[model samples]
Target: MSKSGDDQVRYEPAAPKKEQGGAQKPASQKSRPLLEYSPVYLLVTIMLTLFTAEWLIMIILNMAPGIPQEWATLINALALTVVIFPVVYFFHYRPKVRDLAELKRVSLVLTESERRIRSVMEATNDSIIQINEKGLIVFWNRAAEALFGYTAKEIMNKKFLTLVTSPRYYVFFEKWFRNELDLVKKNHGDSMGQGQFEVFIKRKNEKVIPVEVSLSSVWLEDSLHTICMVRDITIRKKAFVALKESEKRFREALEKVCMVTAQVEANGKIMFCNDYFLRVTGWEKKDVLGRNLFALFIADKFHAALKKRLYESIAMRVEIKQMEQEIITRSGDCRLVMFNTTNLLDHKGRVIGVTIIGEDITERKKSEEIKKESNERLRKANEELQKAQTQLVRSEKLASLGHLAAGVAHEIRNPLNIISTSIQLLSMEERLSPETVKTSRIVMEQVKRASKITENLREFAREKKPEIIKMDLHDFLERTIALVEYEMSLENITVVRNFNSGPIYLLGDEDQLAQVFLNVIGNARDSMNEKQEEFSYDELQKRGWVGQLVIETIVNEHMAGVRFRDTGVGVTRETKEKIYDPFYTTKREGKGTGLGLAIAYGIIENHGGRIEIESDVGEGAEFSVFLPLATERNA
Candidate 1:
């Protein structure tokens, strides 16, 4: 054939059709002619026409009957061959041959197209399948074979939906397929509309996998067929589920974490805050979001500095670790906070904002301060305890010495008494001279003084229990002062009494308590007398220096106190420490036994009372005696 003729019959795959608006439709293969005559039909028609023409020609020859049968048959054969053969060959046989050649070429084109389509479907990772109107599988690619674990030979003509879909989806799939078939038939299969869905499909091994299926309809011959592109989405589904779980855990951690956490923009605007942050700052989500962090929570005094520092840190992309500051709460209370900050970065590692974690340390600071104060108090208490311990040790020694002195006093008193009797007998002799009488008198005086010293030693050793009774403290002190009134007057000492308005009462032995008061009074008088001796009478008069012994009675809810304040030479610290020891005297020889204060100390201690001394050298001394009141003792 000619090149132009070959071109006319040549077939190429259809290009996509363009609509009026220039939109191109999907390319689809065109349908073949609706009425096409087959080879057998053409052969039958030609044979019948030849038979009718020859029969008429033979009848005409027979009607002549003049020539023999052989010549007549030859004539008939020649006419039929010459007249019908050319017409049949040219008008029918030749055209049919050309048609046969064209069909063969078209077949080759279709075969090549099919080969290319198959190659494309096999190359893709997604499974491609085609199902006919009967819902039977007609086409399956290599990907389909790998995906479903079923070879094309095995799966051909098999029911696709029934084999792959689970039983629970049977009704749904049936309805869906029916509707899709109706749609395809209504469009005459020209509309290659596609639908995509995710569904579970069972593999040949009976293991189910999640898959995404895309369906498009196509007309094959006269029947509508569905084309499916199946992609295994098992990994995608798992990744989606894992991502959701990770988000859930992250959200829960933010809500439940103890530290206050927030995200702020570089400009100090809050972007996000956790539940703990909202709770600590006493702010609602709507109120706090997008607000300035420093303006809302930091004090005015710290606002500028804190904001500047935060801006600097953000600009430099520096992380703050344990930076301490104060944050004001909604209630106008300040909380000490330690902050840790980290830069929040974008995908390109550029800083966008910051993440802040604040730890409240207010209580920790208060506890440390309290601990410091407690340590200081404990130190002072320890010192006071040590002083009391030393005083107790000294008292114990004095008591032991008293016991020894008492024994010695008892032995010496007997000899002094025997000597006194001998002296009385000797003095009774009439022949004795006046000198002897005087000498005996002097001996008696010395013996009497020694006896007094022994008496005081015996008294110091005595540990007599108090005869308890309730007595008016004022009257008791008054009576004791009256006993020393004459002696105080002889020493040119003036007594002053400052008594409480109400009667102060105490429970104690009257005699022992009286002895304590008298001893204190006598010491005061002696100290004043010694001070007065420092100035002669003329100098004392000229200076107007009068020795005063001020007695005061003080009362409290728990105790009754008597204060003896004297204008006398005061005791030194060293002297005060040993002042209450037996025989520890500052008086001249033969003047004092020094047992007075010691006995008084024992008596006051036994009465559940105490004596406190306050004195300075040359500033005189004040001795306060405190005894439990009657009401306090009874209670």
Candidate 2:
């Protein structure tokens, strides 16, 4: 780059940018004021001499005047006083006045220069500094203040050598700027902007700073002065550090995303590997970085393809697409990973390295296989039945997911309701009360959030309006039972039931009631799954239960009820109390959303009926649902 002065962004490992062949721009004039030395003293000397000459003339006048004796004596006294006063004033006061004037000029210039330098430095993203020949900081700009945390005033006139550790470099600077070097330069005539050097500087806080030092000989009043411009390259150094850290973090995160990332340099060096890669390949970082790309485990298995894709990426400077390959793990197990290669380019767009991203798609591939088998089994199962089983199973899966959405919404609603109510109540409090007012408002805001969640649950479940129909309750339970029968049988669950035959009728939504049956039955099935492996016959008998599940139905004059009893592991006392809440479930993580009973309760309430549940932790649970019979309907 073209430069009258070099910006200090030094580095030892990397060469500085070569000077570009371009038109040279004229160097701008330096803005700092010239230091005053002889001129100030000369001006003071001239003024004092003129004052003395006037005093002498006055003294001579007093000695030679023609006058009366008394008048002449008074004139001599006045003349002596005049001469003495002038002499005292010049000696004492006038010099002080000249010093004050010079000080004012110096201060004004310093203030103006400080302002300009501060403005430029703060405006720049980089830091600027000036170190004198003795390596003392004479000037520091505002950006330096921000970067190093030291103000100009804090370190001014202090030996700059103290800031830099190992002041041996000061020797190099001294020799470079000494009069011995200048004579050589003067003999050569007009040597400007030469012998520019780069070195790393340490900040006041001991941060390693990179800088470029430019030595320029400029004449100010016929004396040679060297002004070294220091630019701090902390940011560039930080970038280099960040890039390395990012590579490390990338490897760590990839372990979770389950990918193998490798960097291949120009000389075919395999620059990185993570835990999974090592576990799979029996190789460590020692076995990687700077090693030949094709020498690692399973290299021959993938070496040719990798080299081909690598060359393609490097040549094209674009990403190479997914390449499937297998590598033997350190455990002697082979895992499949789909690899992608990309070229890492420099500022000039030359490919300097290649980054390969490999994802272990083995699990995904296995999942696809399992899905195929499940699909075949499902197809066979469907063929053995009507559309009802297929529809019901799908609905149950969707319902399970919907339970999450609904529970979130239902829980949110209560809080949201609380918030809204609190906000309203707050306004009714005495006006302009900050604490009370703020709390109330915050409560309402939270209530609004809950309300939104409720709305979302409604949308997710497609549950907006209650649909009513008179339906046989037993028939509903029978269908839901059939839907889960295969799942229960797979777990070897025994179901017991006793039905008191009666002409029972209920006025309620058939599908919603069915939902209640499905939820209850599903919970019963889960409990059975839990106890299937852990319980013995003796333990089951102690719980007032014999097996996994029991279903019983009965009808009376007022209401028809179904008692769903499960011998599966039951709910805790606490769980029983909250069983009817919208989103409460205890089927373990990722299993239940705790919303089944809540929805069932809502449906029952809408039907002018109610639901109840009873549970014992080690024993089992029973859910009894009652629905009021329709007026005049047979019971």
Candidate 3:
């Protein structure tokens, strides 16, 4: 007998039927019979028939009245022996011999099948055990012996449940076994008797182990028996526990990390978020998870672009590194965040989602902006300080020059008076010729020019403070322009007035400001005249060279400004440095004393005003005079 595919026991003939001399019988010799004859029935029938025949023979011999009794008995014995012998040989002995041979063949087949089954039970890794209906262990294979540390001789015929199950599980094992047996009986050893369960079993050394047991029941030699396949499960249980522990630790670490972290689906829905993410965004976990990432955290203005970037990264299976973005917090404040993203992939390397790590950089960005502003302010302050320093140095140089001019003017004045007296006396002589008188007049003119130069030097050295009063700057400029109007027209210079519509009131001395304006106009007129002289009449016409003096008044929050723009050959860079120095001139001989601009600069400084010059050699020049507004000074 052997187990089939469905685990059902079956038996097959070990060898086919053979004829005499161990040769297989031919197909022609094999035939089906209409009736099967039993040896016992044949023997009984033959005996009955022989007995009747002997009785009949005895009767016949008696009826025949044989001549001699001995002859009749011998004849009867011979007939009966011959008939009985043939019938028994053909009917009983022959069939019995054939039946015995068939029984031997069946016994050989059963022995071979049993041997094969035993070998299979011994070779399998799982422990195989057999228990009878009485709860006694009937079979123990080699694996069972190794697993339980018991030999077959020691464990056989022992109570399996008592020996293998712990005391605490005795009742359970007994109850379970009883139920299984009942179920097997009810189903007549059907597949319903087979099942599997896990349990803790004790070995012979009293060590306990986890095991999985598969049970099956079958009828063996007219008795119910259960076969158990036991497998050790200690390693599997340990590995499962280890995996759970690792997962728990990973989750804890994610929650406690310092940076924001989140898992988002490809569609932009947030799946998981760590504690830091919620803390930074000022959102609760319940409110954040499963919400759309863009809608919840990203501003409306950035929603479309951020969503597009996210989808594109996922589609391309690429990571996003160091992307700066601004997020809206729960309190309606905006925060700058730096994010790094990685794609989450499945086992097949297909994109499933994305993981993002973000760092809040709002404070850092603010600090950078503040530092940049501080640097800009510092630069402007340094420029202003340099300008002040330059002004101070220039002021010191002018102060020394002023003292020198005062001394020179005093020394030259005495000589100029003496020369004037002499020239006048010479002109008074009675016999003076016309030629002599002309020469005397010329000498007087020269002496008077010298006197004017000395007077200018004295004025330049004077440190008189201006008498401050509120005055309309526009009116003051118009008066100053009136003084030079004739001179400018004679040179064909156009005076373009661009004054403000409203009056600009400033605090400055009328006389001092007028002098400053006259000096600046004089310089502009001379520069244009010089430019005109550079070309002839026809050349000037061809070049379209026209002298223009553009005067404009500008008012700001705290100052009133007057600008003088000239279409003239502008000052050179070398000339601009010494332009405000006393006795320095870029004019022809006898044209100017050059004390005019020096005096103008000192008066403007005393009035708490500044003069700024902007010029390029060929481009023309602009002079802007700025003074504090009367209202600003009072305030």
Best model number under TM-score? 3
Give the per-residue Cα lDDT of candidate 3 at 322. 95
- Backbone collisions counted per model: 0, 12, 0
| Better candidate by lDDT, 1 or 3 | 3
Q: Write the per-residue lDDT of candidate 2 for residues 378-453, one digit (tens) a residue.
A: 9977775754564356446556757677677677777667667756876886766788777767766656655655
Ranking by TM-score: 3, 1, 2
Model 1, span 263-348: residue lDDT tens: 89988899888888877778798998899988889888998888888888888989889999988778888888898998988757
Instruction: State the C-alpha lDDT per candidate.
Output: 0.81, 0.65, 0.81
> In candidate 1, what residue range of length 10 has the lowest lDDT sum?
1-10
TM-score of each: 0.44, 0.31, 0.49
- Which ranges of candidate 2 are over 4 A from the true structure? 1-172, 175-225, 232-248, 255-257, 297-305, 326-336, 342-351, 360-635
Q: What is the RMSD of candidate 3?
A: 19.0
In terms of TM-score, which candidate is stronger, 1 or 3?
3
The list of candidate 3 runs beyond 4 A from truth reads 1-279, 284-294, 298-325, 337-359, 372-391, 423-449, 489-492, 534-546, 571-577, 585-591, 632-635
lDDT of 3 by residue, 245-281 (tens): 9858966887889888899999888988999888888
C-alpha RMSD between model 1 and the true structure: 26.9
